[model samples]
Target: MTDKVLALVTGASRGIGRAVAERLARTGHKVIGTATSESGAAAIREALQAIDPANDGIVLNIADAAQTAEALKAFLDQHGTPEVVVNNAGITRDNLFLRMSDEEWEAVINTNLSGVFRVCKAMVKPMLKQKSGAIVNVSSIIGTTGNAGQANYAAAKAGLEGFTRSLAQEVASRNITVNCVAPGFIKTDMTDVLPEAQKEAILATVPCKRLGQAEEIAAAVAFLASSDAKYITGQTIHVNGGMNMG
Candidate 1:
């Protein structure tokens, strides 16, 4: 196993997660990315192998606590404790709060908000012992600015930011920094698959004409993961192109 710092990207099968995994591998980090399924794992392996065959990949459903614990243990048993952890796994169930089913809210909260709690809890001991670590959560613009039909997703993400702040303080003395990155509309398979008219409507709300590239977010992750960002913690770096800046 490469001794360079290991970075884990959850939901790394595609989109921002995939891009971050590949970029980290290229930057010489031992990238161990997670997929929710076998096919997704294979895609991650192929993508990483193309960059560096030594790269690592695994399948994980963060919402499953037992599986999550086992996967993290196996990942470390093979690669090692992560020096950088990106909580990028997420899902969206858009509906008016009044109409949103309990399952929808529970699923989103469990995976996006509660899921991070699970994964981070598992990593805390390892990171604390290491005396250093970095966490970057993938939040959403809707988290800060409530959306019409994404109450569940927005609540989960907003909670994630608060979680980041609380966790950052808890680990600050250990030399670990925790932060979040809220991406605006990013062009990816996830977004590309959206209806064209829907895409146009989103663009109208964004001040910039173009959507963000996955690389842009990856770059932000890389920066925060590096020593250069040692002074920055408990902060949310929004990559939205002038959309809802606070």
Candidate 2:
């Protein structure tokens, strides 16, 4: 790899995305993180500047096709193609299958699944031209285990995993790898709001007896996006603290 390879991470305003962006920047990547709003983008830029002055962030709503295209075009024009892409922008609208509204399902699917498709589509062509790139998608344990009130979230994540495997096969010969990091019960803004009793009940199911940290997931993402993982592709690395082991 070059001394300063270009890397893109979506939803980098906070949580695991921020951690991944920081880790990549520390490892010498010129990171370009993304968020949906100006404030979020500013946060990403500020966080990344602590590591490298050249690293910055952009505004991108991956679920919006036109917005995604415009953002990617501007970014590509300014920074060339990213050597590593992390699809971490996602949303969840948790509701039981019986009560899940069309809007809820579409929101989750469009953002989590289709948004990833759009981001990968924007990056893969450039990656194919470069003939060397790595794409790490952020997935969820609920995708495999199936949560009761997260039908929409689970479906989108499961779809993402399938998409990753298929795209990995398509690009492996081009020297690009596609993989996923599925995290379970990670400590984040979402989990922080859970009631203490609920949190304790959740921890009881995990052999580790604790929640995973954002940095922990970031470590897995870093590994998958590095040259050290060159031999790995079309795989999902679970970072759930033994909550759902194979």
Candidate 3:
């Protein structure tokens, strides 16, 4: 067995997920990142392997419950239980509530909220037997503040936070910590395409007067997953640039 801590990070092909995987690997964790496709997984593998040959990647679609369960079981059988699990896979189907199709709401809720439930259910037993672990679910500031055209996304993220708290209570006795990291407007592909005027408008609301980097969110996740945060559980650490300080 490797001396390094084992960590599983989902949706690690790009953006916040990619940064989280890299940060954990650089911090001495043996990371196994997941992407939805073979090509994306290959990219994650290539990137992480450069940091540590023990690090690897696999294809996992959290939207599929059976596949998630089966894949996680096989992964645990092969790599043992991970000390850390980061649920970062999420999709956005932005539409006004009046215009939003059932598909839009279901897709976001299924992937963002229920998908985390599936992953947690699969891993919680192993983590209980191990008796120590950290789970960081990536939420969004919009979940709290709400946003136009993001009703489904907001509802899913809000539900995720509630789920985090409930699960944390259930597992705290086992020394398993479940927490959330709610990021405000971060600089990613999603934000990069915004009109320059819109981008400026967003920055104006941020006290930092700038967009956050993916690495910044990664740092918070790294801390929550570290031994230093062993006593912390059922908490939501907001990583916005003073955008929403509620």
Candidate 4:
């Protein structure tokens, strides 16, 4: 792949997305990392620049369909369609299924599941014409194991896997592979906010004896998005450090 090939990483302001953008940039791809706020966009830009001093950053809210389309179209118009797209923009509206509000459920689905669809739909045209591309959706261990308070999040992530598998088959002939990475207990901003006791309890279950880093998850995404994984598609690679073996 050329160093100029553009890669778009959603939720790139921090955590796993930021690490993934840095990794891809280090590999020579001109990465575009998206954030939701002005501060977030600034942060992403600064973070990416810290890695390569020339990578791009933009603001995007995946849950908003119109903005998602417009932002992607703008990016493609200015830089070119990203050959690699990472669907890492996700949110959690954690609550028991019984008490979860409809809005909470909708917001989670819109951002995590439908957001991936919106992005894939916008980018597939150029990828199909080019006849080469890769998409890696970020899933979660909760999606597979069903965490009690993360009904909305788990459902959305689980749906992303189904979408990846089906879309992989649809686009494989075009040389565009779709896959997913299910990360567990990553020490991200989200998990950092977890209660100390909860964090400790969760850490005990991880055989690695510690939480995985965002960089660890980024490594998996980089490998899967590279030509090294050309023959791999429609697969979900777990990066939970032996938390849930499948």
| Predicted structure with the largest lDDT when compared to the true one | 3
The lDDT for every candidate, in the order shown, is 0.89, 0.94, 0.96, 0.91
The per-prediction CA RMSD against the true structure, in angstroms, equals 1.1, 1.3, 0.7, 1.5
Q: What is the lDDT, from 0 to 100, of the residue 182 in candidate 1?
A: 92
- TM-scores of the candidates in the order shown: 0.97, 0.98, 0.99, 0.96
Q: After superposition, how far is residue 97 of candidate 2 from its true place, in Å?
A: 1.6
lDDT of 2 by residue, 96-142 (tens): 89998999999999999999999988889989999999999999999
RMSD of 2: 1.3
> Where does candidate 4 stray beyond 4 Å?
1-3
Q: Candidate 3, 128: how far from true, in Å?
A: 0.4
With candidate 1 superimposed using the best TM-score fit, by how many Å does residue 178's alpha carbon deviate from the native? 0.4
Compared with the true structure, model 3 gives a TM-score of 0.99
Model 3 misplaced regions, further than 4 Å: none
lDDT of 3: 0.96
Cα lDDT, model 1, residue 33: 86
Each candidate: how many clashes?
0, 0, 0, 0
Residue pairs with backbone atoms closer than 3 Å in model 1 (clashes): none
Q: Enumerate residue pairs that collide in model 4.
A: none
Residue 168 lDDT, candidate 2, scale 0-100:
96
Best of the candidates, TM-score: 3
Candidate 3 residue lDDT tens string, 49-137: 99999999999999999899889989998999999999999999999999999999999999999999999999999999999999999
